[model samples]
Target: MHQLVATPFGGRGLILRPGSTKAVQLPLARFEELRALASALSTVPQWLIGPVRAQWNVDLTSRSVGDAILVREAGPYEFSRATWEINLGCDLDCSICYLGEKKFEGLDMDGKRKLLAVMRDAGVIWLQITGGEPLIDRDFPESYQIAHEMGMLLELLSNGSRLRKPHILNLLRTFPPAKLTLSVYGATAETYDTVTRRRGGFDRFREGLEQAVDAGLNIDLSLIIVQENAHEVEAMRDWARQLGVPYREYANISPTIHGTAEPLPSQSPQYLTNRAPFTGCPAGVTFFHADPFGRASICKVGREPNIDLIAEGVEGLTRLGGIAESLMLRTGGCSGCKLSDSCRVCRPMAKVFQEAKAPLVNYCQHGMR
Candidate 1:
């Protein structure tokens, strides 16, 4: 039988075995040591140390009284969360956009249905829609309705260009979004337009956001920091505060890697990415991404195909399951991180690259407090 044992010393530590739970407080120095140990364990056979490692930081264990545990061959698995790229097309061409150099073609309804069928079969209960602009896809609301009808929770990431259209806003209102993440290019039009490379974008984004809030959607701000606007962090954060929404800052990854819509030099690693590698990436575990290109990835940016949901269908996902893989991958840059307890590493990044990979450096490495 297996059980879960978490000790406070490890800051959200998990030990598998049958036993009662207790808490322990250690000096910050000792806590750091435990964090390192946990990060290391992420690389090896975590299951052998206890029971199965589930996704989203869940540790699955069997009890002497529970069902028999079966060991099976490893294969692609079903998805828990699905990312639907409505349109590869975007209105703005940012120099640092990860998908900027990539094409922004929209997905047809048939493609959307095929992807949804795959997700439905995989028992994916959650869906996140993103794009050059999801609103650019005429059938987006229909797609959302399909996912909602299938009982999947929905999250949307948009640039806020189309929200000014009452019908579009009405369509958006169809789903009580679990969360709506609006990308904030800058605090002011000059800064915002510069990043989005679009004229009058700040106005549209602001108006759309107000409508979204008026529609009673849970809003979150997504900010991308670059050399040009890095200093605007406080200002951007203040804007989010004014909107009464939480903000998440994403460092730019190499845009060339994803073949975005426009040609832009890759941002420097100093501002391009974060150093706090989350040990708990939700890939294969709790989430997965299916792009319009007919490729399914463990993460969003890279289109590495673990399975083709379009071809093999969602059943192909179960064949390439996630929990086990997530456990095997070490949390990068998190080797000696202090936020282990609260920080969940980018599972998608860790899964694609090794813990020792150079890009794993997170914010901690940049001297950010």
Candidate 2:
């Protein structure tokens, strides 16, 4: 096991071992300083240096400690983080689900364990367990425990409906995720129910949030901006503030994983129209996603399977680097467009539009301009 684990927030911290109970928090800079001092001293015990050297893949003789730990570059086949879609069986039929009305089929417990092992061996440090609703997965408790035992920093992304259940709450208390991100659809029952189209979703969400807080779990609230819930955005923020929980707003909506624009209608047009320069995408490079069936892709939005992780294993991930490189290159009409300067459009979506020539009016705001 690695002596120093990377936190989800991008800092390095020590997880005390040898029958230890908890992680010891440390700042990145300070951890680096200790590592440097330890590396320089020949008198330091081998037991102390062994784990750090193995974890960072340090060459003590040739490379400086600063150089070794400063930047972590992933090899072609390696990934730092992975998002595993445990199941697609969400209880609430929200107006803006990226997967739309997808059928839910997940790996059996044994298969799931194998997949987790593959990810761990492939060097995934942070594993995000997401779903239509992760807590609803019948095998979630065992799966969560297995991942935790494998030394992966886990993040649970859920609608927070089932989290109110005693069994689920107990599971969280026993092996807490590094972070629990709950999706808040609206500020009140009326607005939330309107978006979810489920009668008691808001109540269940509230109850779940309370249960998680009572369990002393780290919680983050994410508000999805859509036509039904846009009016209550500020109120939702205020509610998160009142609860003293960190909150963020997601205004951008993407097409379904199947390449259909089902959720596009629910998106706020004003939000789509606002443009920014195209920064780089991290998909297939530092991050990857695996669907319920173990098909791997660069991201959720770009669900063109680059590999079948269940069949190919780590070798398949190497092919993703070339795929990622190709996806980043400009395609079709995007190559010489005047609006390219301020385009916020991503390459995958651009490729979709280019091939179809379908005027995704909201997505192609620059075209209208």
Candidate 3:
């Protein structure tokens, strides 16, 4: 579907499909003008806007064209959303966590505030507050409040262990987030505790969900399917449905932030094999990730920092445009691979191959042989 996205260089990008390789870039003023014109002719059929569609290779007959034309326009900053890992300290130890056991010395309260301000100024309307467990951070309330006061839609990613706490619930009541996404380990306490390797995790998770729902908070649940909990997939979905809450399922498990494939052992090979071809990654194009220390990159897997929010401020974002462009160009072993259409190998993972010559057996079904 056609949609307006963010460019690495703090500009606008148009994606013809959600993960399609075809896209176009436009400056903020031009994008704004196009959106305005699209809104003015909202009732007209998209096919009638052939001239506009042709400019960006948009499918004229696609139903999403009109909706995309009048998309949420990013302000001067260009990026619509930002995922910030507020901290790396967690209460539970999940064997399949992408971050692994790497200790992160996050920014202080003032440093975090500066990073938030930079993100807000960049026109990021949606800020995802995540962490090893964001609720554990003493500065989480203040940082969350700052984003909320700035009128940014905030989404919290958590394990749901602390949501039952009186202070945590009080903070949420004061400034409710747009949504809270909790990761469900398993359907039963036995399986859940086995996956998380923590006693009483399932009980705490249930309590947290109950608290959030009772407080009238929107909640979304996700299951990261692994060998440890694959058998409980159906049961987990049924449980979520019974709660009348939305749920999603994920099968692919990538390496840790330190580029270690420790989580691969838990991944379901069949699930990884069923993925579609590598269309493109919206990393430098429409998405970005920032670690706890204020280092921003194109994506979480692509750890090469394009900007240091605390040290360089918003000006650092300007360097991302070139990085994004460079990433778009196929290079290394992927430059002329014949399996491009059916290959699930993404650029960041491919970079790992090119640099370390390590085969991501779990990520690539074909074994990259």
TM-score of each: 0.64, 0.78, 0.76
TM-score for predicted model 2 compared with the true structure: 0.78
Per-model clash counts, in order, read 40, 0, 0
Q: Estimate, for each residue in 160-210, the C-alpha lDDT of model 3 and write its tens digit.
A: 999989989988877677688999999999999999999999999999998
Question: What are the RMSDs of all candidates, in order?
Answer: 14.1, 7.5, 9.3
lDDT (0-100) at residue 287 of candidate 1?
Answer: 69
The model with the greatest TM-score is: 2
Candidate 1: tens digits of C-alpha lDDT, residues 112-222: 887776676665645788986888778887887786655455788888888889888886675466778888878888888887788999899889988888887778888
Tens-digit per-residue lDDT, 1-369, candidate 2: 232332322445443321122444456665555455545742323433555455444433443333322222223354878999999988899767877785678799988987887787677767899988888889899988887766677889999999889989988887677789999999899999999989999999999898788777889999888888888888999999988899988877766655566676788765454546677778888789988888888887667746888898877888777777777777666777666655677878766555544464645655566
Residue-level lDDT for 337 in candidate 2: 65
Predict model 1's lDDT versus the native: 0.59
Segments in model 1 whose C-alpha atoms lie over 4 Å from true places: 1-78, 252-256, 259-274, 277-280, 322-369
Candidate 3 TM-score over all chains jointly: 0.76
- Of candidates 3 and 2, the better by TM-score: 2
Candidate 1, backbone clash total: 40
Report residue 130 deviation for candidate 1 (angstroms).
Answer: 0.8
